[model samples]
Target: MLITQCQQADVALLEEHLPSPSRTSFHAQRFARQGVGTSTYLVAWLADRPVANAEIRWNGCAATEVRQAVPNCPEINGLSVTEPLRGGGIGTALIRHAERLAVERGVQRIGLGVDDDGNPRAAALYARLGYRPVVRYLDRWSYTAHDGEVHDIEDPCVFLAKELTSAPTPDLGVRVQ
Candidate 1:
């Protein structure tokens, strides 16, 4: 699978391949508005079909606890994989790509908030990926939908973080004279 930053051309592809009510287009617009290096919308493609997607926000949002814990860290948000393809490591790939992007931007840590009461599987996946729970907080946010309806969100959330470190270069075995 190839993980790539969402491009204008990929927007329609995402709408075609991903589930309905998908936020891929919304995220793509946000990425465009925020410009490169500030925000990102990533898509995981399997054989040219988008299978999963996620976003990274440099200016953290919501998750008051996460901001208190790591004020300068980027947060990975809106991680999603197609319902039929959840267990295939697409989510993991998206996360790792986010981390790599963070590291490239000179960020030392990354954060994300998982709903404690909604999806424990996501929390478990974050734990397995080396994120440690740092704080618990009530999440509160609101947004406008395409249908001109405003939606409010409030959930019990756990903020998790992982410190990023550069990987050591592998040494090729060779005989030295």
Candidate 2:
């Protein structure tokens, strides 16, 4: 297994695993354009093939509800392990990598949202990684299911957060157990 920063060539590979909003080509382009700002993207490769992905970002107004609760918390924007690789520990590995990235970037905390259905295992995985529920914002809206919807829209988006140590680069001291 190898963890690598994404390049232009891997844009499509990143897209395949993103939620619908990121399926289009330019989404990768835009994310790449950010080049490690409040948000950045990463790909987890297994034996030369992209098998998992994660996104790390600074908490901002776009995350108004999240910010209101955990002010200035850095966010784990997104993460996913391909279906075939789901139970092989790839997601956990990717998330741990993101935690390291957050610590390296001087971020003192992390946040993310998951669906209410409990179908997406990221919530459970993050829980194991020291993330705890900080806030839960209800989205009183609905949407049609299409081929490329990116963010979660499970009526109410459940927000989770974790406090991170900012002193060291590559710190994985975060523990949920």
Candidate 3:
């Protein structure tokens, strides 16, 4: 599999691989953000097809608390692998690649927000990757659907961050659970 930061031309691949009715333009938006240098849209391609995707937001997560807790850390966001392709190391590779990219950009730390109440497996993965909890926050955000209808989401979450260069973060709370 080949992982590459997506350009404007790759939005079609992201949508083609993860077809979602309500998520139209999501890929385009990510590409646009990449265009402006605020983020990077990374796509994992296997056999000439996109198999997984994630975005690295240089400014951290949308949650105010998360951003405040881990300022200047690039937050890995929107990581997803097709349901049929889960547990195949695709997601893991994508994350590692993201971390490497951050390191290349002179970033010393990286972060990601895991849905605390709904995703234990992800939390476990982050722990194994050396990310520790830094802050627990409500992930409050919104997006516009393809129909232009705004949708809001509120999920209980914890911000996990890892050092890329031996620059440790002071422990903020309990282990991922």
Candidate 4:
């Protein structure tokens, strides 16, 4: 897989693959954030198709607890891989790519939130990637769907953080689509 910053051109591929609210005017929205240096949205491609996505929020998570605890840490949010191809190291590669990008921007740490009660596999993956639990809270957020329907989500989650050093970028040996 080739990991790179998301572009407007990738929107349709993401839509056909993941088909979620994340694509709700997100091409332009992500571009705005990227242009202003506030966020970086990354897309993972396999065979010229988008298979995964992640975002780096340089200001840290918006949640009050996460902001208070790791103020300068960039949070890696909205990570998702296509369901059929998950478990193939695509998610890991995306995360490492995000971390490398963060280090390039002078970030010393990073974070991501996992569903506390429902996702043991994701928690384990984060643990294996050197993230440690730092804050536990009930997170609430809302999103507008592609069809103009708004949805609210609440989840019990733990935010995991990792200290980033100036380590050499790994040769993930990704196979691009």
RMSD of each: 6.1, 5.4, 6.9, 2.3
* Preferred candidate (lDDT higher): 3 or 4: 4
True-vs-predicted CA distance for residue 12, candidate 3, Å:
1.4
Worst 10 residues of 2 by lDDT: 168-177
lDDT of 2 by residue, 1-177 (tens): 777667777776555644444334543753664575656667777665777766766644245677788888766655767787787776666667777777777777777777666656766777877778878776443333455454554356777877877642332332221
Which predicted model would earn the best TM-score?
4
| Model 4, TM vs. native | 0.89
Please provide, for model 3 over 7-103, each residue's C-alpha lDDT reduced to its tens digit, 9 standing for 90 to 100.
6677877777786556557888888888898999888877678888999998678777877888877899989988888887777787787787787
- Separate clash counts for every candidate: 0, 6, 0, 4
The clash tally of candidate 4 reads: 4
Writing each residue's lDDT as its tens digit, candidate 1 over 41-140 gives 8888877788888889888756666677779878898798998999877787778778877877888888898998789889889999899988888888
Q: Estimate each model's TM-score.
A: 0.82, 0.74, 0.86, 0.89
Poorest stretch of ten by lDDT in candidate 3: 168-177
Candidate 4 per-residue C-alpha lDDT over 1-177 given as tens digits, one digit per residue, 9 for 90 to 100? 688787777766777776666426555565568778899988888877888888887887888988888788888888888888888888999888888877887778899999998988888899999999999977898888767778898899999999998883474686433
Assess each prediction's global lDDT (C-alpha) against the native.
Answer: 0.76, 0.64, 0.80, 0.82
Order of the predicted models by lDDT, top scorer first: 4, 3, 1, 2
Off-target runs (Cα >4 Å) in candidate 2 are 15-23, 26-30, 138-155, 166-177
Give the Cα error of residue 113 in candidate 1, in Å: 0.9
